[model samples]
Target chain A: MAKLDASGFLIDLDGTVFRGQELIDGAAEAIHTLQSLGKSVVFLSNRGNLSRAMCRKKLLGAGIRTDERSIVLSSSVTASFLKKHYPLSKVWVLGEKGLTDELALAGVAMAQKPQAADWLVISLHETVTYEDLNLAFKAASSGARIIATNRDRSFPNEGGHAMDVAGMIGAIEASAGAKTELVIGKPSWLMAEAACKALGLPPGECAIIGDSLESDIAMGRLYGMKSVLVLTGSAKLGEPRLYEPDIVLGSIKDLTELAKEGILL
Target chain B: MAKLDASGFLIDLDGTVFRGQELIDGAAEAIHTLQSLGKSVVFLSNRGNLSRAMCRKKLLGAGIRTDERSIVLSSSVTASFLKKHYPLSKVWVLGEKGLTDELALAGVAMAQKPQAADWLVISLHETVTYEDLNLAFKAASSGARIIATNRDRSFPNEGGHAMDVAGMIGAIEASAGAKTELVIGKPSWLMAEAACKALGLPPGECAIIGDSLESDIAMGRLYGMKSVLVLTGSAKLGEPRLYEPDIVLGSIKDLTELAKEGILL
Candidate 1:
């Protein structure tokens, strides 16, 4: 492949930059190199369990210097979408602290009872109860608009895999007999738009580098941005090219090679 | 439309005999009347949250005289199925105390880790956590056989509807990329066989009377039993007759009227 140039970098966190608590080799240096080259970089994450500040702290702990403002989370995108579309609406949330914090910061009123809510926001949580499911079902049956952060069923954890938000979303959909009206995460235009806004650049000038073809690469292609797939994550090289990425590299370390070859400007 | 005759009675508990704490009108009297006529009756329940003892206690509290031997619960059916099919298997349970207690009684070895389980038994509980979901997903991905007590999405409670085992099942199926291998509850032949064994009668000689056509009537039809639908619960008069019941009544109180009309043989 010839040298490819980009003005803004949209990077994934869990698989590309690190896995669990350990940092991927050359990830921090690659981000620093891009920054030295005067490229605007935003860390994009589909995880809704942690707040942007917590995400930034984790990135910093792994030797990457990024602020909360430079972290684009699906929770933030969802909050922004709710604020713009359903202003001052009573909302019921089924997520962790990260998602709830974002909505509160957006000044959206939280509904104590599910039936009282005009909207329902669903995400992943570590302690979901049957009562929560009943509440969500009741709210949805009463005509509450349903929205989800993402639909990734399982994510790689310290163990083989852990249940993600998609599992919870599927359960709610099955019980409520309603589908999600909006999904503000990777593979959706909403996440891409949010990242572009953070970078202060147009979609044409931005490139997204991540591991999963279904989410990261699909999102990039949906918004007409360069998509780079790294192999240090969920996807493998020999897998079917369902969502053909713009470029496939062995790891994020190849970003340094792309820089050395004058591919990344 | 004339009073129907049957040998044994297969009755549902929640909707037909009682609704929550209040017993349905004439339900106890109808059962007593059937007993007085020397007819065998078995109470069938899809609820897995309570053990047979607890179920019997609840029935007795509601002015009915039924022993544990005459009650057939989904949990007991599941336990029996597991003991017969996956003998001495290391089972992991995701259910309430009733299901776990039944499995323990069956002497099936319990697995603490998901990967260590040879079988996964899923049921409903009020306090399911995300960690439980992750373990179930991991076990299922590692080839653990999945079984459920029932697949009812919701049950009618005092507050409209409460989420049931189907929601949890759907969530695990979505995350694990696998479906349940066996569901030993309503609409399954397993429950019918258990009920028939309890009554010492064949399916053809028994009649099932309940409110929901989807469950009680469907099971009866599946096993060639006489299906009766009562309109005191979920189903209405003019809805789509997906599974037509042999007879329909306004409530279970009409069973006495059927006896008065010389239908009880």
Candidate 2:
């Protein structure tokens, strides 16, 4: 089969380019190679702990030059999607400062407390407490729409791995007897759409590169993009057979070779 | 407050005396302290992966001395409990060899996989597969009585951990759109009654000591047993306030002192 032409690149962060501030050896070079070939690139991350500005700072700090327009974070996408779908909804957030700020920027009103909420957005919160859990349970059980940011149970941390929003949401869902109606992050179609919109290209005209099968490859498959599994991060040397992406490479260093191969017809 | 009368100790293993192979630091000393006070102590674990002999061997190896008579694995209790409640019932189990053997010993016939099963018993299995998940889901959705050994997501491993039967059952329950009717492990009144019956003591007369507030302390609270929280395992320092156990101690070293003070009334 001939390689499909793609207009842009949609990349994932944690398991793709870098894991907790350590950039994959050749990932940045791949993006530069794509840019030099006249292709747009946008990075998407499900981590809601940091703002988009902070993400750009970190990426650039890791030697990968990035600007505000070159990224779309899950927090931003989720907020925008929720605003578009449920305009002026009274939303309750079980998340951090980034999530709250993003929702406000999207023109969504934050519910004062659980009892005053019409919808519930479950996300990762560093200051998660029992009172927050109790309030979330109340809101969810009272029939609030439960929207999760992602289903990733854990993520890389500076010191040690930590339970992400998925773990917290799992406990809340169990207690409230409600399932998340929508997930708006990596592995979700919404995050891909956000990236495509940023690049002014259709999802079908993009290539997704990441190191994890369940998230990056799965997202690429869902969005009709060419998926490249890289071994620099979460994808181990012998684990690519499980997802079966369109391309398997050692690192982003091979992007020039892929471009030269005329696969992007 | 006056010292409370205590009959014997009923312990839960998973997050209590030990997590996986290593015993809680003071768990062995706690048992020795209880034994020196002439209080009978029995080890109980909800893990259905091993037989009674295996459980005994493992506990002994971990410094918590136990004989077959001094231990109660959930599989054996489940088999006996099912036989007592539903004589001639065809039981379907998604578990290991130990579970099947225990049911056989109870004179209960194993039902036809999932198609003809009357009840579903979920237990920990090292060999959990997609086929097993499908079978469990089918049986649960087909109006079978759903019962689980416990509600723990992951079992403690030597270093990290592995997803346990509880997580597997949670997935099945999610797909079936129904929660299990009963959890037969510690903190549940069913298994607590069985332990009380074996000790030939009234529920109010028995006492439980373990490291988990949700399971062990909750069991004691549910069955009217004096609950003692020991910090040799899963329960951290501030966990007791959430469950409110009757007695809170850092370790089992205080058992002899309490007994001498006529706490075992």
Candidate 3:
């Protein structure tokens, strides 16, 4: 089966491997199994507000046994895309500390003034202010290119789903009469390209497993990866399907059952 | 002749009446002439961030004698609409002092906490904060009905167009995945009704003169009132027409010219 013969796998972090502080059943064991079988694995996280380092630590705490290098964060992908494509441009960022920290660590040049920015990177900021929005508006009106990390309205937060970065983008675009030039996050080619490069595999040689039909499963469908859906997170059964997966299981624990059926090495 | 035959006039404030501390040409003399001719004149302002009292005082300073009773502000229309449709509901307002002050003056019950709000009134707030948006999100998720004053992305400011209430609405809608229930502003039936009542005139007996075809002229078309386009503001010559007007003029001062043509008493 195409689903069983992948050399590399891009796995979603949140909801798939763990939920908040608790690990999903068989997630760690499945990763260990895949690694032992000589399959390359990369944890792909869609949350831009968290750096790869933080996600790695969180995964490690949950017994996922993954390093930072093996984790591909949306923010890190954004940083790399900027560094490679717009190396000479100065960016004005609107994000939380984690996203800014990742960009800083990646050595991206930041603009001191919004009006002087060559690019305005819009991301989630919990304490976003009118001043921040006004500055971004100024940057947009002054001809700065806009790029957003993710357009998801909300994400699962400790106290329920919190508003995401799209709010920040909506404000700037509304004021300046401009549209975002790029979006580097799940279900987009930019994100898919990043995950493939991290695992050193072509799209046809990789399988993706996650709990979200919109983001994770859609990514698999768009990038031509073998997709598997698990019932441990935000996805519900038969919820207005946008993308169909090759397999659906009770949990990652059932993945080991596939090998018993001679579906894998 | 339909433009000149109106017994009442709904005049747009900013680009048509005045622009940033300066009166448009013939605005003062035209209003005085219209008043002398026994025509009911109401200055209809779309800017919700300013109270009726503030607009009246500004008009009086520009040698255009007008009372707060004759000025219809969008915020006041929203306040009236809420008080009429949902008298017992507790409203949580996201606006500047002028809007809240007007709502308070109108005796609308205000909700102290966003979560406790029964209706969330979204308007323009220059110093909007993350806490405000989060609270709005909380209120929306708690099942509060949402109503916006205006959805104009921006309005003409001293430096340029300043962002309007749409940004705040965009944020709350994005988070809650809900659409605004009502928008009480220009081109909306609520605003038209309010303006018509203020002038004690029927839709056919009233004419709206303004710089924006999308807003002022559209209101006339929707409500069956005479619509006059002025070259003095946001509108331009042949700017991809949405609403066609009965006549176009250089300024409101040219209103008397219609009388010279024997079109009115």
Best by TM-score: 1
Q: DockQ score of candidate 2? A: 0.03
Q: Could you tell me which residue pairs clash in candidate 3?
A: none
Per-residue alpha-carbon lDDT of candidate 1 for residues B1-265, written as tens digits (9 for 90 to 100): 6556678999998889888888999999889889888889999989887789888889888888888889999999988888888887998888889988888887778987889899889898778877777788888888898989988888877888887888888788877888888888898888999999999999889999998888999998889999889998888999997799988988898888888788766
User: Worst ten-residue run, lDDT, model 1 chain B?
Assistant: B1-10
Q: What is the DockQ of each candidate?
A: 0.68, 0.03, 0.43
What TM-score do all the candidates reach, one by one?
A: 0.92, 0.54, 0.79
Ten residues in sequence with the least summed lDDT for candidate 3 chain B: B256-265
| lDDT for each residue of candidate 2 in A1-265, tens digit (9 for 90 to 100) | 3475788888878767886768777777877888888888898888775568778888888777878777888888888888998897899888888888788888988888676788898787756654465567667767898887776655566733444676557645665667888888777777887888889998788888887888888888887888988777667876435557887878767776777888755
Sort candidate 2 into its docking category: incorrect
* Each model's Cα RMSD: 2.5, 14.3, 4.5
The residue-by-residue lDDT of candidate 1 on A62-124, one tens digit each, is: 888987778989898888888888897999888889998998888888988988999989888
lDDT of 2 by residue, B187-251 (tens): 77777877887677787877787777777887888778888877766777754365677877766
True contacts kept of each: 0.69, 0.00, 0.51
Chain A TM-score, candidate 1?
Answer: 0.95
CA lDDT of each candidate? 0.86, 0.74, 0.84
